[model samples]
Target: MLVFAFQISRSGKSTYLQQVCLVVILAQIGCYVPARFATIRVVDRIFTRMGTMDNLESNSSTFMTEMRETAFIMQNVTNRSLIVMDELGRATSSSDGLAMAWSCCEYLLSLKAYTVFATHMDSLAELAT
Candidate 1:
């Protein structure tokens, strides 16, 4: 199932993602996840080991760094993989960023991967229809 969560910062959006990621990882490893009587079934390998770009002191432009990380994810993701992408393509111009974001979503759709993409780009919701 594709789930879209929209909320302001400091409203537990990131916390929610962290919880979900933890549960999925635990489930993948055959560990018990306490879910308040709800069963969480994870059927694929979780890829949550990726590092954030926030601490990296890269000489490359922000857009370039974003694209590099994005490309890495695209190369490694599978149909059953769960991807959590936060604020994708945010470093470029609005038009370029939106286009890149739209294209990335399109490619992810083609793969049928379960993705949780958090973004301020409201137009991206239109891609689902």
Candidate 2:
């Protein structure tokens, strides 16, 4: 599920992603969810990536930190993983970010993991098709 909330739209994309991941987690643990209906898949791991954050101590910029986290996710994820990522390429040039995000989206899709990506970049939504 790729959500395109649009840049600076602030349509609660992050919140929606969080809720979905939470619901999946709750259902996975055999806990009663508040929803009327749910079909939770068997997930071995739940990975979430948020917006940019500078690794100042390590002398890394915000974009570099974001890339590092994304790299870690790509390397570690499996088909049984549930990946809820938000704004993977937010702190760089629009073209660069879009390109990187697009590639990341493709790679994630190829892995066949249950993924929910929330992005402000509208172009990334094309992956939904």
Candidate 3:
């Protein structure tokens, strides 16, 4: 889902996305979640793409590294997979990034995986409609 609130810019959305994935992980590991009404869907795998992730030692730019990771996710993720991508398309020019994000969103929607995508591009929220 596209988070629309401007106040969530302080990494709150990223944190929130992490919590959801963590809950599923905790549940899968047999840890009892203290929820009065919980129906956590069982998933095969969890993939995450944190925006600032980079492999500096390998001489890979953050954008290149993230692109490789994103490609891997698209290739490996399944309907039962859980995906959390934060600030996709932010490593390049704004227009380029938004274009990439837009296409990625379309692809992710087609896959029907449980996905949580967080971005600072407010225009992306329009895609929800």
Candidate 4:
């Protein structure tokens, strides 16, 4: 369910969103069925903000890791769960990123599953407007 909305700056909005999601997940501890039984998806794009240099010796770029993680989430997400996504297109070109983000949003909404997608893409906000 879409809960409350606040009017802080963009940074604060993002932070609060993360915190709220965390709290909700925590609050669900005793209430939800076994996690494996629940079918919610959390889709955060890896490497959306920080670089993926932790495995430099293994030669895994942030972009590749991000793509892999996104693909994995999309593939594994169940229909009965919530999705929490971060910046969806931060690793690609602006236009490409926006397109991917838009399409993902459409897909999630199509599923009628609870989703919380966080993005720096202003165009997405336009969709809500």
Candidate 5:
């Protein structure tokens, strides 16, 4: 099944993609896995993005928070999971980010899970061809 939640004003693709990942993860928890003896693993490589937490007090820096969030995404992903990732290294230099994004795309292509990657890296678009 597919689930999408997006708006015309903003880039809602990522949000909808995340929803698909969540659904896939949940579905895998029950009949899907037990029937096929399969597992769900998701891996993400998002660029700079805010954490779900909303804190007014002092805390980690932006860079620290980004790293932590990325780590969390990766740790939570499973093989049978659907990965919804944004630009991988967008917070860093362009070249660095492109390279990171390229590698991530390659990694996902290697995996058997469904992936929805959102990025502005047209260079990597060649992968689709």
Candidate 6:
């Protein structure tokens, strides 16, 4: 499943992504998830931050950090992985960011992985078509 969720900050977009991540992690660990009924198969998963890299040392600019993390995900993610990316390419100019974001989306699609991307960039919706 490839899903794109578009919403403003604090409008539950991040919350929703976090919830999905939590559920998937719990399922992978053989723990109980709070969902009423979920049949999630065990799968590897990854999440990309909206602005910062968590727990990683990086003196680079935010855009560079974001790209680095993205490259990591692209390199490691597999067809069975579930990827949840929040606000991809947000640290750069709109044109450059959108182009990179679009390219990433295309690459992920080609991998046939399940992906959930949350973004404020409406232009990215075109990828669905």
TM-score leader: 2
lDDT of 3: 0.80
Off by over 4 Å in 4: 1-10, 31-58
Answer with 1 or 2, whichever has the higher TM-score: 2
Error of 6 at 10 (Å): 1.9
RMSD of candidates 1 onward, in order:
2.7, 1.9, 2.3, 7.0, 7.0, 2.3
Would you list the C-alpha lDDT of every candidate in the order shown?
0.72, 0.81, 0.80, 0.57, 0.54, 0.83
- Indicate which candidate wins on lDDT: 6
Please, what are the lDDT tens digits per residue for candidate 6 over residues 1-129? 679998887898888988988888888888998979989866766655554644346557777788888989988988888888888888889988889889988998998888889988899898889
Clashes per model (N, Cα, C within 3 A): 0, 0, 0, 2, 9, 0
26-51 in candidate 5: lDDT tens per residue?
65454343235535443342222332
Evaluate model 3: give its TM-score. 0.86
Off by over 4 Å in 2: 1-8
Model 5: how far residue 80 lies from native, Å: 1.6
Candidate 6's displacement at residue 103, Å, is 0.8
Better of 1 and 2 by lDDT: 2
For model 1, the stretches where C-alpha displacement exceeds 4 angstroms are: 37-45, 48-58
Candidate order by lDDT, highest to lowest? Answer: 6, 2, 3, 1, 4, 5
Write model 3 residue lDDT over 92-112, tens digit each, in one string: 899999999888887877777
Estimate candidate 3's RMSD in Å: 2.3
lDDT of 1 by residue, 77-104 (tens): 8888887766677787888888987887
> lDDT, candidate 5, residue 109?
68
Tell me the spans in candidate 5 whose CA falls farther than 4 Å from its real position.
1-9, 25-64, 67-78
Provide the lDDT at 110 for model 3.
Answer: 79
Output the better candidate (3/6) by lDDT. 6
